[model samples]
Target: MLRTPAAVRDAGRHTAHNYHPLPVVISSAEGAWVTDVDGRRYLDCLAGYSALNFGHRHPTLIATAHAQLDRLTLTSRAFVHDQFADFCRELAALCGKELVLPMNTGAEAVETGIKVARKWGYQVKGVPAGQATIVVADGNFHGRTTTIVSFSTDADARADFGPYTPGFRVVPYGDLAALAEAVDEHTVAVLLEPVQGEQGVVVPPEGYLPGVRQLCDERNVLFIADEIQSGLGRTGATFACEQDGVVPDVYLLGKALGGGIVPVSAVAADAAVLGVLKPGQHGSTFGGNPLACAVATEVVRLLASGEFQRRSTELGERLHSGLRALIGKGLVAVRGRGLWAGLDIDPALMSGREACERLMERGVLAKDTHGSTIRLAPPLVVTPEEIDHAVAQLAAVLAG
Candidate 1:
């Protein structure tokens, strides 16, 4: 019988079997590498689903967290803390928005956007309560919350979790015509990921986002962008929406907002839209806690500093070009923006999971989505030499 590590066995026995994570038991991580309990190391190509855009355990974020911890931790929404205003201000400036509402997770940020849109529809757009409809694209992965799962196109996510929240309409992704047909007077917002991260890093057509923005403007509906998985310099820009020069009415932020050290997320918008929520309307106990606020503040600064964004852009081009050279050989195609690339493999030859497993054996770590597509989103801090090494490992894996 194969013996498993005590840590791994203990987790399996005690924890809910919600996730089917890779078998490697991580013991520690720093920068772009993670070491397993058995002392093996691998380049982290997933970056915690882009949550580690700053790389793991970044010194600046750690220092900030340490100082803040000594000062204070949680004060709840019952009272304000010093880090709260700074976090909001910095995040708003980073998003180019007028106001921000802090939350603790990507799902909460998304949920907040939904509530704000509905409230705006009732109070400002004159839609009746429980009648405001929000349009969402198919193949989107917002989060695991019940209300979020209600609109998911993925069967596994929606399978047994329901009584399902209502008031959402589904439209075909990348089809502007479908979206145009779906929207009407009662439509409050269009919530979508700029690039569908979970659906194999699926990128929409060039004009899709700009077109959606225009359509929302024409219909007087709010354009809500769920950038939790794609924003904060993940796609070589501060926000993925910047690629099209479209400023969404509301931006849902999470993941990398915590710099991979804490749970930090927020929703940013102009006051008119987010302002619809009165004091007692919505909040989270840990939202904008001092520790989260400090870490997120550092994250926003690093993202806006343009260092990591440039690295992601430069290395992204290198990685994509290298991977594209394998087309018609092993990879079917490579598609994505910046450091986030999706490798579509020949299904008959090997599944994406197989490719990732092979890569793992060769000292690289990545994840597969859908079945044939593997996503590669290494930390923005990854070096050119590291990129070459990772690509070489992947090339060898495919060649074998």
Candidate 2:
């Protein structure tokens, strides 16, 4: 018989101590629920940090993956595959961009965006060679890449990752004045998450995204929206920027793009911006492979139907409303859009880690960030009852 404690301990015995996972030993998952190795069940509220926006092994996505797996999988960028053009065309259409450059991870997409922006800076924007600067926001979580971490304000992510890459500037998020001041002659792009997911699903002030778009246009800089966590129906819209009534010059997308099955990411931009890349400039072998494209193509189809987006909009109201009702009871604050939310548990009562552990014991899985902030991003397939149950579990944890 598989036991939870021994399984959990053995699971971490050989791996790097990078993640501090919960005590639950999940063996299989379907939709919004998972079964532990010991046959215990729990609700998955984190949703793979939005990677499972469509839910675990969604039928269509799984079918597509299986079909593609039986066929071709990879051909590299050297030769075009059957699934390449359709995925790019559909995703570009979804993003309202002229071209899409595929990669295998969100970090790679970020890196690709940086490279493209710099190349566009020199080739089109006429910035001095090797002096192009991309301004980013503080409290941002782009990725763990050294270059992306260079402008990160999080000490844990930024520390010891240097001598950090230069040519990037960090400004306080949601502060248009600071951002405007930071943009100057050599500024190539302003990269930001329309909604900061890792910093506890933090949403900026209203009009902030539009103001950035206007500033980027006025400054001849690219507005790169890193929507890895906020796009593809996670934020009650196709993209979170849409909530603020703005469209960025470039879209850095990943996470949910692969339907939680494979790692897939892409950077979408108009020809004038992305055309700066020549052959042999930047490429990924697994990017746009048949399996990734097949799954992502289904993902695009799913989002195109607008069902998940609508679910996020309608259900998010319920989730947020329930969370707000607990403000004085235990939660200090709640912030997010759609089904994505970050709850700040009253630190005087208990830390976020403790809250998550307690919630875990109650068969609800959640993750905590910073000190007292808990992020809840249940799958879009999660029903109203599941949301209420998760919220009730949270209330119970707080009451105790």
Candidate 3:
């Protein structure tokens, strides 16, 4: 096995310095845990920013990928592969949509949705060309693309990345009056995350999603939910919109759709909205590759099975209750749903990053976001015993 220092040195020599990950160098990972290059194991509470909801190296997803690799891999969009249709059909059913356009990354899915909204605005809604406006929420993290970052509320993501794209209107999140004030005749859509994951797992006020849905319906605007971070059974449901019983016009999905293996993402919507795309409008070479499609098919099957979702719901309750018990002790507050949670630490006591570093030394792995908030989203496959153990470790770290 490679030593941690050697591994870090090798990566630093070859790869771009884009991330500031924790010091631990992961060598291998399995359900709910990762082993570092030094052979020390830690529970992966972060789960790759909710990308590994199925846990690391899930057996079913790995088997599907292997089988598909032995048979076929890529054909490009110029031609269709055998796995594409079934993947699309199942995903469309899962999304309750009439069409699905595959992509390889969450950012690509968001870009696709943006394009679709613009086209629909011009062609179907009869808006002037290139003049459509999409309403977005403040403090939302869609992706790191230039256009996506154009409307970001974070200074770090937007500072040097400009000159940014335009044609977006930003409003305060969870404020119905502000959202209503932002929409006008030229508004094409309202794009937002059901829960702001990167914004310290900030959940919108109750009735926010449903209220937005109603407002969109009344205003003839497309409601586009960026579910890439919060979807695919991450929030104890197949989709976070299910929590509010509201369905968006466009469902942007990614992350767990690849089953913690390859990158598989898509935009799902009814024909009336998604049908705006014609030939030569948009495409990706490896968007619907055979291996990704196969893996994603099994992912959809597992997500629809209700096992993972149920586990997230139950374990989340236990985790939240445990953390709530520690609020005055060290934690400032706890906010989230299902297996996803954000623990705000009292700044006077310790910072979120400090708590996470301490937790890492104690055999738990998590990441902090928005300065003082640590987001914990363990894989849905984690057992009850593991949840208790993680809570105990966190509590001990806080006590220390």
Candidate 4:
């Protein structure tokens, strides 16, 4: 007789069903693999939605975190800690911006970006107070906060989360004309992900980012690129905007910034744009604590080395080619950049949830976003052979 796993059953016994997770309960992880409580091993392809981009327990990140724990952890925003300046300066330089405002989570970073843009519009851009509007892509997945979800096109993330926040205009993601038509004198900023992670790792069409940049520049609107899931080496570049030769006025960053040890998020921009915020107007108690700063500073230095970015670009080609070959046999299409990819399974064969379950049974862990789409974003530390193995396991799952 087969018994249901205790970890799977107990996981939902007292918790909310916000996430329909796979039945595997991870007990330990290293590089790109995790071990279940029962001692079974599985290759992790989701990489915590890119939060573990450097892989689990990276040596530098862990060491820094440990040292900080021994020294200091939190001091609040009242009195600055020793590790704060270095983190802010280094991360700002990483984004090539002059200033940075650290926060705690990806959603806080998005909300901070929205607040800064509106304030900048009223104070710097000469827009009328309380009339500023920000444009967002139709299929964006910035975060689940009430204000952030107000503009989301995904019904599941937005439904029942209202009366939603106002002043956001939604436009088709890849349509420049629609975006341009949506913006006007009252527009303050345009927030978007260069690669929409939750919307199945959807990469916009070529020239779409450049067009957005041009539109924002022509209309004097700040361009805020939400790089929470697409930045910090996941997209083969320090920032995904570099892929299109576009530099946004503000960069919303998080996910891997904390090295998967703590939650660290930030908004970066030149002084003129972010200077609109007066002291006490916006701050987080734990935004740049000693521990978060220590860990995140090392993360910035790691990205500065560009090794992870190189690995993502080199390994991504191999991964994508293999996935494309399975199109007619099972997959319908694949789209993404760098180490990120969205695989569309033939719904006739199996839904994404079923495919993921079958893959988990074969020792490969992945995630489903939409009905038939699966997102693959293995950590940059993953090896070429491991990538091949994951692809093979996926193919076998489809075959069955």
RMSD to the true structure for each prediction, in A, is 1.4, 0.8, 1.2, 1.1
Task: Give TM-scores for every candidate, taking all chains together and pairing residue i with residue i.
Answer: 0.98, 0.99, 0.98, 0.98
**Which residue pairs clash in candidate 2?**
none
lDDT of each: 0.91, 0.95, 0.92, 0.93
Clash counts per candidate, in order, are 0, 0, 0, 0
For model 1 the TM-score comes to 0.98
Best by TM-score: 2
- Per-residue alpha-carbon lDDT of candidate 4 for residues 176-251, written as tens digits (9 for 90 to 100): 9999999999999999999998999989899999999999999999999999999999989998999999999999
* lDDT, residue 381, model 1: 88
Tens-digit lDDT string for candidate 2 (239-265)? 999999999999999999989999999
* C-alpha positional error of residue 81 in candidate 2 after TM-score superposition, expressed in Å: 0.8
Q: Cα RMSD for candidate 1?
A: 1.4
Q: What ranking emerges by TM-score with the best candidate at the front?
A: 2, 4, 3, 1
* Clash pairs (backbone) in predicted model 1: none
Alpha carbon lDDT at 219, candidate 4 = 99
CA shift at 186, candidate 1, in angstroms?
Answer: 1.0
Candidate 3: RMSD to truth: 1.2
Off by over 4 Å in 3: none
Compose the digit string of candidate 3's lDDT tens values, residues 142-261: 989999999999998888998989999999999999999999999999999999999888889999999999999999999999999899988889899999999999999998898889
Q: Which ten residues in a row have the lowest lDDT in candidate 3?
A: 1-10
